[model samples]
Target: IRAHHADLAKLLTSVKGVGPTTASTLLAQLPELGKLNRKQITALVGLAPMNRDSGTLRGQRHIFGGRADVRRVLFVAALVGTRFNPVLKAFYARLLAAGEPKKVALVACMHKLLVILNAIARSKSPWSNEIATVV
Candidate 1:
């Protein structure tokens, strides 16, 4: 039974506020890979960047608004992610200095976390740091 959601399950194990139930909800709500491109899938899950492309409108990366239930769990996980995930901690601090709301900064960190998960699932590797990538 469509157990690819198990990939999400595995990733969530190390994240906070992401027990089986929360991970299950995320999988249920996110787009199936066949239904959308990777970018689109991230957007559908409310994890992609948003742009306000127009004359002097000021483009910004807005958060996923696709599913409230899914987003709620993500918020909690995102909070914890900032504290524990090395990459997310740096991102969160940078975003905060840029004057983004605390919650918004947390959400941006969440997006980075999701992107990392996407790669981890594709590569079948455990989480590693940007430091590792660079060194």
Candidate 2:
């Protein structure tokens, strides 16, 4: 797998929390990873919030309908990222400080992590903390 999608897999696993299994799952299951924009990619991975509302009534946005396998692996990676990755750790802390629930904060980290991976893949660049800071 890495032999074929070497750069993509390498770039993803370069992140603090992503492992070979997660990277492989992404490469195999999420072919649209680098091809889409942030919102598009997150939505594809089932990380983007879906609105549950009727006309003139804004309800809580929930995540649904995408690659469940990918989302499942991402959830595990995001949990590790919140502790090991400096940028993600800070982001997770900020979300908690703002009164976000633990699950919500973790999902948001998953979203951010996927976005950063997508950006790196699209640009054909290795992961960098400097670039991650911008996300």
Candidate 3:
């Protein structure tokens, strides 16, 4: 994979917690990785939150309807990222500190991870702490 798609492989694997399988899944399953904007990419991956409001009753926001296979891979990556990736770790901590549920915080991290990856891919650059933080 590296020999054939060296640039992409490097870019995808630059982030912590993103291993061979995650990179491979992104490259193979999400061909539109770099081609789309942040919102577009997240929606495509089903990480974008969907509204669930009805009349005066406000329902809990939920994410649904996108690439399940990609979402599954991202879920694992995000879980690992919360522990290993500095940006994600900090973000997750902040969310939890703000009283967000574990599951909610993790899903937010997943969305963030995907956005960071999307930005890196779009910029055609390898991951960097500074860049990740900025994104």
Which structure among the candidates has the greatest lDDT? 2
- Backbone clashes in candidate 2 total 0
Specify the highest-TM-score model's number: 2
lDDT of each: 0.63, 0.90, 0.90
Error of 3 at 99 (Å): 0.8
TM-score of each: 0.68, 0.94, 0.93
Cα lDDT, model 1, residue 27? 67
Show model 2 residue runs off by greater than 4 Å.
none
Clashing pairs in 2: none
Ranking by lDDT: 2, 3, 1
In candidate 1, position 48 carries an lDDT of 75
As for model 1, its CA RMSD to the true structure in angstroms is 3.9
TM-score for predicted model 1 compared with the true structure: 0.68
Candidate 2 lDDT over 1-135, as tens digits, reads 546598778888989999999999999999987799999999887889999899999999999899999999999999999999999999999999999999999999999999999988888887899779776
Which RMSD values do the candidates have, in order?
Answer: 3.9, 1.4, 1.7
lDDT of 1 by residue, 1-135 (tens): 466667647765544434676567666665452344457656877777778779978877566476677667777777877787666777789899999889778877666655555555455544567522332
